[model samples]
Target chain A: MKKIVTIAREFGSGGRYIGKLAAEKLGYKFYDKELIMLMSKESGLSDEFIEEAGEKITNSMLFNVAMGGVYLNPGYNNTLMPLSDKLFVVQSNIIKRIAEEGPCVIVGRCADYSLKERGDCLNVFIHCPDEQKAERATKIYNMPEKNIEKEIKRRNKARSSHYYYYTGLDWGSPSNYDIVLNSGSLGADMCADIIADIAKNC
Target chain B: MKKIVTIAREFGSGGRYIGKLAAEKLGYKFYDKELIMLMSKESGLSDEFIEEAGEKITNSMLFNVAMGGVYLNPGYNNTLMPLSDKLFVVQSNIIKRIAEEGPCVIVGRCADYSLKERGDCLNVFIHCPDEQKAERATKIYNMPEKNIEKEIKRRNKARSSHYYYYTGLDWGSPSNYDIVLNSGSLGADMCADIIADIAKNC
Candidate 1:
């Protein structure tokens, strides 16, 4: 049986690179930025719009507080809301279809929650220490050394909040995932190797 | 800085053994079954009583239904309840003291949630496929093959529900844990070795 593997990762954790390698090694289709393009093509939405809204929630913390509660109804009422919510649903449908097609690796975009009902899905989260993430941002991404930590924290917060708005579950929690790994010591290739092994067996 | 490593695992996953090895590798104190004894001494609870109630909640699925709602009060009201909750608090205090003493590897008993406030803590969950778990039970523990699957499922359910009742969190969610690994593929030693490396650096 084909197994769907979804990876949620910290920024600069090499999750995209690892997912790509795992897909290649397992002879499975890989989705990352390509998922954005796919969603754009399927939903007739602009790629730029989808990309910007992908990691944002319907409301900010300030908006939630102003509303007198931290809770926002997730039900679709057909009223005009943020494009991100629409994009999320579109991509969720796309993800479900992809999983039905065959085994594949999906990186981020809350693919795990999208396919939560599928028994064949294996959700994985990849993370690393802040120092390593900061170093990667500085060395690989050419981010300003002084701002690396800030950028890393900002991106992680965005991802966490985005996931929470959609799933009502804590991001990176083990109960929300089948497998969680720290790439701080293993690096991308080694991490992918382990994931690929599990994917094969699963 | 001293780091505390807490491992939560499936029943037959050899978490305790791996914890011992990791503790030895890092020259840290190892707590497994020994934790029960320590808790008994500190809280004046009997070891056998703590052991039996350790990985259990107030009730199983039946309790969830009878509670009128899925949620139950986690607060203490000065009324008598399950010994498991008391044992949990006792162990939590002991685990905190051990962590404050120095670096150590504590296995099971919701140690991850107990030490969650510590910035120096690394939480890990170890798991494997059912077949692998069954095989390990038969080979390592010399259990009869017929009951392996049933035993595995029952124990995991107890652990999961216990964790939920006490911490109100899923037992193995990556968001609640720092690292998760499949012992089916790597076995205990390799998992411990990888964990020790992280613990040493962390």
Candidate 2:
């Protein structure tokens, strides 16, 4: 049985819901937005700040240049690190700690890349067609945007950029994940069921 | 129940094996290389020629330019159509006819694009990591290539180009398929099981 399941998803793809259902079916702890709370508590950063800056980087290149000087120091002082980099380190540590605790489902926040060294991790990506995503954003997410499609695209771009910034990997690339499921076509429940089944059997 | 299942895969991903297993489990007819015979009988092309040029295009751009003159005629006179285009049309018609008969599993030949209009079709793309694919090619396929990795890349590129030439869509894009399974991680049996389960319940 797989010990760790990481779900990376497109915005408005109902990925969090699928992760929750799969975790319930597998009887594993589920972490999504809860990770933000954990990170804030662990890092002494405000919850609101962690939520805002956790998964969305403003400019990765600039951040990299700014942090370049600090890389030479093996001691790696956290005070010298940028706030975004510090948050990522803290979040990654928490995720690793969670993995060590037991089998669990973690959604978003680059858990797949964070736990890449683990032998028993199952990485999944959930995506949907743009039309379906727009509909879900309006109906399920209740987003108050005039152009929900544009909003969805913007958020997805942010997520992708954030993922790339941290992991140096393309977000949502099938090669990076064990399985990629379309919630629109398979339905969220079936997607969750498949994840649970694969976790149990594979 | 899904009446049609279309699989697009990398060259050495064991996609055909997975499709066959899924079809058997679902009690559906499976088509892979068998479609070559059907196409040859319908198009009067030799099985050998179809096997060589069926899924690999020589040069799609030149073929497109040569066939451009025939597009104005809605009747699409076969005498004026290029041999490659003729082969594609015949193969697509055969695929459509097969779908019309009943539930079936088709491997390659862009069956997903051919049945894009069908509401009951499940399109799946199976992929594997390069290392795993190389190992499979060397061991399971018994390929006699000194550089198996290069051979695998060449075959995959040809498949991608052929797919793009015909469908004007990326072959393995997640949005174009319902689910993309990685056989390297999930194992072929579990991948087949997931496909069959999704087809039956979704």
Candidate 3:
């Protein structure tokens, strides 16, 4: 009732699915890859750029401080430096844009830290066991078991970095979230239903 | 199935109630006050002394250097201490005993941190909105509105202190928990059912 529900999820954890279902059940708008599209349309940024940067943390004082806050001149053929750097800028705007649109479920891309300024937002982290994630990732993404492990490790590390970069807090800490659910054990449908129920009751 | 579950919750969040329900639904024994009673019996410590010093933390160098290096002294009394300190010791031993007895749902007294070394333990934090907690305190504890504020603050502060003192992590942080539930909106019974289903499936 008084909070916007934001879902932070691990890769292949059915985060987007649960977010969509909960939003639909609660009659709230859902934002995921769609958020990147919206951000692209609004900011005149490319979908590719938006996607790479969205839901990530890029601005590290460590980087700026390390480089002595100096700008490098005439870098050639730098199509991508570190997507993480540009991620915070794009996703921060996207988060604000999504939150401004009204009460909705925004999936991952660091929306939790993005909308922390809003007192009415309820941040949640959705995760399942690693085995579940690996299985799901292998099926959905058509990746090998090793690839799933790599994907999970890489994405989880990225999100954790983004969280630490933006909020100066660990990504999965219960303290940062209003609710944390295990989709592996609960199933995505039940997780969504439970979340929707919580949203309605709130 | 591989891990134990740890619960650190607000005073009136019906932490014990939900924990017991989860254990029962799973056919696992529930350890609440019984844990302390058992530890008291096993450790030759009094109920009163164990409860007081068990949950509190000591900042000695033993725990600081290394976890295995740190030796926990769960005796009745050694020197100057507050009531919280006594509670910490008793609860700590109870947590260890329960974990040794095999997996069980242990509530409050910082059971989560106490059993952190016991591999495969799931840590959970349960919280509700301030308004709901105050209401529960008033209804269950028979306290007035003004008194409710103080009591809630005192208890939450105590939990926070007890948690931070031991974990080296901020209490209530989203990163610190596997799941954090806000039972305020859904109320206690519904909250219990949802968690029960989650645990079963999880």
Worst 10 residues of 3 chain A by lDDT: A67-76
Candidates by DockQ, descending order: 2, 3, 1
TM-scores across all candidates? 0.57, 0.92, 0.62
For residues A1-202, could you state the per-residue lDDT of candidate 3 as single tens digits?
6447899888878988998999988888888877778767865656875675565435656654543342323243544434344445556887897688788988877777777788777677888777888998888878877667777888888878867876788787655676788777557887788788767665
DockQ of each candidate, alpha-carbon based: 0.19, 0.83, 0.30
TM-score of 3: 0.62
Docking class for candidate 1: incorrect
The TM-score measured for candidate 2 stands at 0.92
Candidate 1 Cα misplacement greater than 4 A, ranges: A60-78, B1-6, B9-31, B34-123, B126-178, B181-202
Off by over 4 Å in 3: A60-91, B1-6, B10-31, B42-44, B56-105, B109-123, B127-178, B182-202
Worst 10 residues of 2 chain B by lDDT: B66-75
lDDT of 1 at A51: 80
Q: After aligning candidate 2 to the native by TM-score, how far in Å is the CA of A74 from where it should be?
A: 8.8
State the displacement of the C-alpha of residue B187, model 1, in Å, after optimal TM-score superposition.
13
